[model samples]
Structure formats: C-alpha cells, structure tokens
Target: MKHYLPQVRFWKIISIILALTGVLFTLIGIFCTEGALAVHWGSDGTPNGFAGKIVLVLIALMGVLSMFSGESFRKERPGWHIPVGPEMGYALSTGLTGCCAGVNVIVVLYYFRPDERIPAVGAIAIIVLYLMFIMIAFYRDRRYNGRDVKTGEESHR
Candidate 1:
C-alpha cells in the first residue's frame, strides 16, 4: 500500500454518511408528516416538521458518503464484495438522496401555498455539494483505481 492511502482514511468516514442518509430518507418517507414540506411548505401542507429534520439528516449522510467513496476509490482493490470504481457505490448512496430531495421539493411546492415559506435553498445547496463531492471522488478513483494498462486488469500497485 502507498503511504498516501492512509491519509485518505477520512474518505471512508464520508461514505458511511451517504449510506446512512439513504436509510434516513427511507425512514422519513415512512414516519414523517411533513413530507410535503420537503418542497418548501410553510405550515399548512403537512402537520409534521419531521420532514425538515430528515432532510438535514440526509444532507449530512450524503456528504459523508461522498468523502468515504473517494477514500475507498483510492484504497480499495478488486476485493471479493467490491468491484472497481467509486461510481457504482457513490451513485447508489447519493441517488436516493437526490430523489428524496426532488420529491420533497415537488411535494412541498404542490401542496403548500406560496405565502408559506419552507425554505428549500438549503436542500438545493446540499444536493449541489454532494454532487460535486461525488464528481471529485470519481475523478480521483479513475486516476488511482481500475485495471493497469500493462496487463489490462486490476493492479495491486
């Protein structure tokens, strides 16, 4: 292993965040009353303020996933359970986040009156950041991961 590999341990921490956020989004859909507020409903839409909490939780989770994916991309070889590239893993984690964010935004706007402000700017920002993180992670993974050109297969180096 390269000395730099250990330096990226922080990235794994990030990945777990993404995975857990997916779990949170699933939970919110089931338990929260303010599913509509995800779009930005002020008060009238859904009785539950839980949607906001879920969104916040989701944002944190995605951010963590992005970081961890990047770390693993550099560190993980073609092991038993893992394939190659951070794309598949990162996408799986963040896709749910993006979907939930989209759904929340839509439902919030559709049901709630405009006069009521739920504030979706934070959610939008979170999505953008998470996406950016994934991009960076994938780029790094591409450089460090995958098969070596010499043998056209995974390289231990």
Candidate 2:
C-alpha cells in the first residue's frame, strides 16, 4: 500500500485539476453564451438538438462529484473493496471528469464559432485515451498488489 501511495496521489491531483477545469469551462459556457446551446450534433455535422444553459449547471455538478469520488481513492478503508483497485478507480473518475471538461470546451467553442466543423473524431480519441488510462492503471495495480492475475490469490513474494 505504501509503495502505491505516490501513484495514488498523482492520480488524485490530476482528478482535481480536471474537475476544476470542467467547472471553469461550464462557467464560461453558461455566462458567455447568449442563447440555448447545442447539446447534440447530427451526423451531418450540424447541431440538430438544443439545450438550455441550465445543462451547464449539471455538467458542473458532475465535475464536483467526480472530484469527490477521486478523492475517495486517497486511502484504503477496512472491509471496503474496489474490484479493480483504487488506482483504477482514480483513473476512471479522473478520465470521466476530463471528458466532461473536454465536452464543455467543445460546446463553448461551438457557441462562439458555429461555422467551424468540429470533428467527432476528437470525442473518439478522448474515449480511447480514457480506456488506455484504465488499462495502464489495472496493469500497474496488478504488478504491485502481489496478487495473481488469474487466481486472485495473494502471492507470497
């Protein structure tokens, strides 16, 4: 556990930063935009659906919740079990908050400049990056936790 402390702390800090970024983007979108923001885009690269500015508030709330959830991974509690380990939890939580931040930024950009075509590939890239983070965390946890990957039994070491 002590050996993994630094890694856990690093992820926690990242999660905090991403959450704060999300909140900032949400604020910018809410106050800066003049009308209903486009929350969804069609396959033709046009915004076919709209949402009230209040939706930004929900995004901000998700950011706050992600921050708290990531912080929970700071320490291991007795009798509490995280199947994928705390490291993975931290990574996933941070990644999710990061995605929210990214989306917030995109929406804000779209509001400011509706003429530009924002490629959906960016969203796909974010998802891939997030999955990579989880895989890295899972492998790292397995390496340090002294447990067999297949049997789930603790190794003597």
What is the TM-score of each predicted model, taking all chains together? 0.34, 0.72
- Candidate number with greatest lDDT: 2
Which regions of candidate 1 deviate over 4 angstroms?
Answer: 1-11, 17-84, 91-118, 146-157
The candidate that wins on TM-score is: 2
47-112, model 1: which lDDT tens digit per residue?
Answer: 334354446455545534343333344355555555534454554344444444444444434344
Candidate 1 backbone clash number: 11
TM-score, candidate 1, is 0.34
Instruction: Supply candidate 1's per-residue lDDT for 68.
Output: 35
Residue 20 Cα positional deviation in candidate 2, in Å, after optimal superposition: 1.3
After superposition, the stretches of candidate 2 with alpha carbons farther than 4 Å from their true spots are 1-7, 70-82, 115-119, 146-157
What is candidate 2's lDDT per residue for 1-157, written digit by digit as tens? 3332224776777766776777887888877788899878888888998898878778877766765565456556787665556777778777877777777767777888784365375577578869887887877688778977767788898
TM-score of 2: 0.72
